[model samples]
Target: MAGSRRGSRSSKKTADRKDKNSLLGRWLRRLIVAGVVVGLLGALALGTAVYFAERSLPSYSALMNSENGQTIVMRARDGTEIVSLGPSYGEWLYSDEIPQVMKDAMVSVEDRRFYSHIGVDPLGLLRAVWVAVRDDQRAEATSTITQQLARNIFLNSNRTMDRKLREAVLAMALEWKFSKDQILELYLNKVYFGGGAYGIDSASRKFFSHSARQLSTGEAAIIAGLVKAPSRYAPSADVNAAVARANVVLSQMRKYGALRADEAASVDVSAVKLKKESGGNSIRYFTDWALPQLDTLLADSDSREPIQVWTTIDIAKQKSATAAIKANAPKGAQGALVSLDRDGAVLAMVGGTDYVESNYNRAVSAVRQPGSAWKLFVYLAALEAGYTPDDRVVDEPTTIGNWSPHNSGGSYAGEIDVRSAFAYSKNTVAAQLGNDVGFGTVASMARRMGITTPISTYPSMVLGTSEVRVIDMARAFGEISAGGESVEPYGITKVETAKGRVLYRREPQRGHQLVPDYVAAGITDLLQTAVATGTGRAAQIGRPVAGKTGTTNSSKDGWFVGFSSGITTAVWMGRDDAKPVAGLYGGTAPARAFASYMRYAVKDRPVEQFDTDLQLPQWQLEPDDEYFYGDPNDYYFIDEQGNLVEPSGGADNGTKSPFPPERQEQSPADQPRRPSRDNETDDSAPSAASDDFLERAIGGSLENGSTRSNRPQQRSPSSESEMDTGRSWRSNPPEGIIERPD
Candidate 1:
């Protein structure tokens, strides 16, 4: 009976403990539930606050103000764009200006649901999110056209949370401020198309010669495809990539019902009409001529403002010059050309064989040694010293400095006239002239003539050892063409704003007289002989012309700089890296290019005679003086030591005298001008009897129109002892010898 009672009490106690545990568990569960509700409310409140905080507080509102700050205009200089440089090597077009077919293609390929979505597409985002969630990956953008424009215009290409946040915010703001059309238009305008074209207008004109409004379906689609990656899809650079991009656009267009499957398959992007030469690419040449002018006009401080530049570049001339260079330039060789007026108007400029291949302009940017072409200045210096075309000079071997320049034939002949020596391009004779004239005189003449390149006189400097560019060379010739007035090349004729406000006008920089008119005339005459009977024989035309041919020491640089009445042209051919060419010389390569260009340039214009021809007398071969040599094959002169020397130099520098010693004694009182006391060259002035002859000489004045003389060099006594053997006027020429005085 007692055991039964105890069992019943234990059961009662166990039941009471179970009830207590159940009640405590229920109470704890209710408290946890309450805490969870609070945490959920707080998280919701925080997310809402953060979203509202950034949404209303703006960072940038430049959509309108940015356009106000920058302007895009095409200048009149070959109709090239004057705009700020962007991050691509090519151009981009605005969406509205793009052809409908191109626009459809782009939208279809890049974003088919672009028009249907707001800044963010919910469906695309959901699909992306679902796929990412299923695969445990991250979601990128579900961007619409507006969103893309916002990204391109305002945000950088970063995938960071901050950048994405800003882009999303800007995109929303953009949607509020702009309609779909406006956003699409901005996107099209800002996206880059390869090949230096920025807008649809520029690209259409560049690729098809037509306006963007006229782009055909295939053409439009292909151009549109380029926007994704211009260089990758450029036809010239990578036709395969372009075709692939075109196919993708076509496929998207078909999916979007813009084109039928059959039509899309038949579309031949490869067959689309493409020009070999991009339109208005000629503007590239002006990069060298125009950029410097822009900096000068805008003072480099305000170049960002829109400015219209008017230049004298003739599209036709530039095109023709470029074509000639492209057709004739040797493989692996490049060239540049510049045509200017006597007034320094830059009529045409070609900076390279192909600006597409290189932007390093060579016409005005490259510097190369001028070779024998520089002898033109030396010849002018000789004219200043009173030497005439008929003056006898030996074509014998001569050494200037460390370099021993040889004649074209590599052998020396007997004496010849200055005209023939220059005509034949005798390096030895030119070096001898440097010996006669101080090198300083020649450099001064070049500097005065607007040659900005520093001139140094080495023995080979007479043969153009000093380096110079085509523009400087053209300017050097320009000074002669400018009637001895120095002129800086004029590029921008006038500058104006888009609002018709005149900003500035280029006042062509001109210098004081570089050389005496008569002396310049005489040099022009020698250069004329260069075209007529000399190395530049190819340069002769129906009208009077003067020019010089240049070749560097290793035949690396070739040049032909010449002028007539209205046009002065400089042509240069060489390797950009200064590598030697295949047996190329100036007379054959550059001379031909100059001839072709000049012929076509003047073909349409009325025949205009050379300006100086009227000012200078016609050349006439006069009768030889009694003292002149009888032998046609040879001439004689007195050496410094008084040994008889047969004439060696072409005209003036190398006369061979039967009597070794030069006659420096007092001339007959009847002489019009007294010869120099040194008596190295009796060329101060021609005798009165030879007046008509000097008038016919190469130089007309400052020789002051002296008669041409073939007088032998008369050696003086002190020349042997006073000067070093290496610096003697006869046996040894000075290091930087140039022209002697009248």
Candidate 2:
């Protein structure tokens, strides 16, 4: 009975244990099923959000449509293509036709995991997100090759969440629709590689002057590097920046195993050879000169398409001007020439002697002292200050503070008219006039005449001590030719599209009258004297010509600024370093250059005369007592026999004249003259001793033992010291006189 009871309790215990085990198993199954249900719900929610997000995105119909039309062409005034903007769209290249090396370089630099990624790089996107969170939200997006192609083809580059999402969606769509090679073809065909080139075909032609298939690895890397910011890395805009980006691409190419380390290291910027501009090297500088102005004009216009610039450059004239510099410019000396119309149209420019050797456009870039060429402004100021050309200013030695300017000829003219002073380019007179009218006034006048460079208030500024560019000086002289109108020098007359659509039609620049017409006439007349008869004689043409010659101190700079009715031109010649050109003078080389250029430039133009009817104040010639000739009686007269004959107005008539005397000193009606000084011995006539003393003082005495004062007149040591003290301010003249270049 006891064993049966123990077995039943054991059975009950086993059943309870089995029941607990089944309950636990059912709870575990239900928990697993609930967890699966929760996961499905979360996936469904996510899928629904993705579907809606994708539905709102833009369509990708144009994702692969990357065909561009005709290339933009820039024209000169005569409708010749000076420059061509945009690339020639060669036939669309298949992936296989492109150099495999090019493809490797492009892939290495732009998108490394191009083969493995679906469309969007999940790791890259996560990294980009982390970077964005850590940095600013607007950090550069980590776009894949496919994503870039989608964004470039189907959308504008507006960085927003919506755009990014649309870009990702379109990238996936692109990947689904096209093969990897096709996607790459689209990317290559669509990317912008600056200088107005779009896609690999155009970029290859534009930069390397070759087909895309022929691009070397280095060229490929350079072209691939331009896609980031084409304008910034443009070879034309900044070659060094472009080279730096290319090196980065090369480094990436090496890292990605696209190229061997040694191969990558061997590549450099020199490996890429950019195509020469279409207009030929002859007009290259003219195009460069007009580029900045073109940008400004375009900015002001409403056009968005590539433009054709109709410039004032006459190709023939440009050639002639350039040839003139090459033929006439001194060896090792830089030369610049600018020719413009009275309306300030830049007709022709030669910045340097040889553009092939150096592209430093000295015509527009170089700044040097105008030398006497700047005197025009000073005289203009004098005119404005009520001083006339006829007004006589003392040309004698005049000191202001410690600065005493001498004439370039090293001799002073006693008195001279302002016109003569300007013609001769007398430094003392100009400095005096600058002080008279105030240097500030001269600077103001220069500013009005288009000298935009800074002008100092020093007296030396009248001698063109202030540095000025060749173009500005040309424009300043142009103002005078333009009948007192302010100059706004221009190059382009029209800007149009390649298809003949007008973009910017240049209107005439109307300048306000800065100087009265009569005043301009007066200045023109004075400048005419400089060319006609004075220092600028070298610049004389058959007809009326007016200009100034300038040579700076030490012959560092030589300049000639001149004008006719149709054109005003400025020519400058100098060494790149401020070393003196031995024996160089403005009246020599620069004037010759100006004349040579003008002879060809104005051969067809009519000779026109300037209006010289400015009603100016009449000035009288003032006789100066200090500049008088010696006594007329003491002077000799030439007889008909060509013999020197003295007047008979001698003290002793008893000594008969060997040659016949005009009149005897002892006139029969005249009484004996009284002695003027107490040292005189007799009233009849001064003794020989007095005469000898007077002659010795008037004429230089012999350096013999016979002293004027029997012994050297002893002076107090203090007197000698005082004389020495007074001489302190009188410095020795420099080895080369600091004469104005004019």
Write the residue-wise lDDT of candidate 1 on 507-529 in tens digits.
75657787777667777777887
TM-score of 1: 0.54
RMSD of each: 18.1, 18.6
lDDT of candidate 2 at residue 699, scale 0 to 100: 62
Report the number of the highest-TM-score candidate.
2
Q: Report lDDT per candidate.
A: 0.67, 0.73
TM-scores for candidates 1 onward, in order? 0.54, 0.62
lDDT of 2 by residue, 148-178 (tens): 8877666767778999877877777667667
Best by lDDT: 2
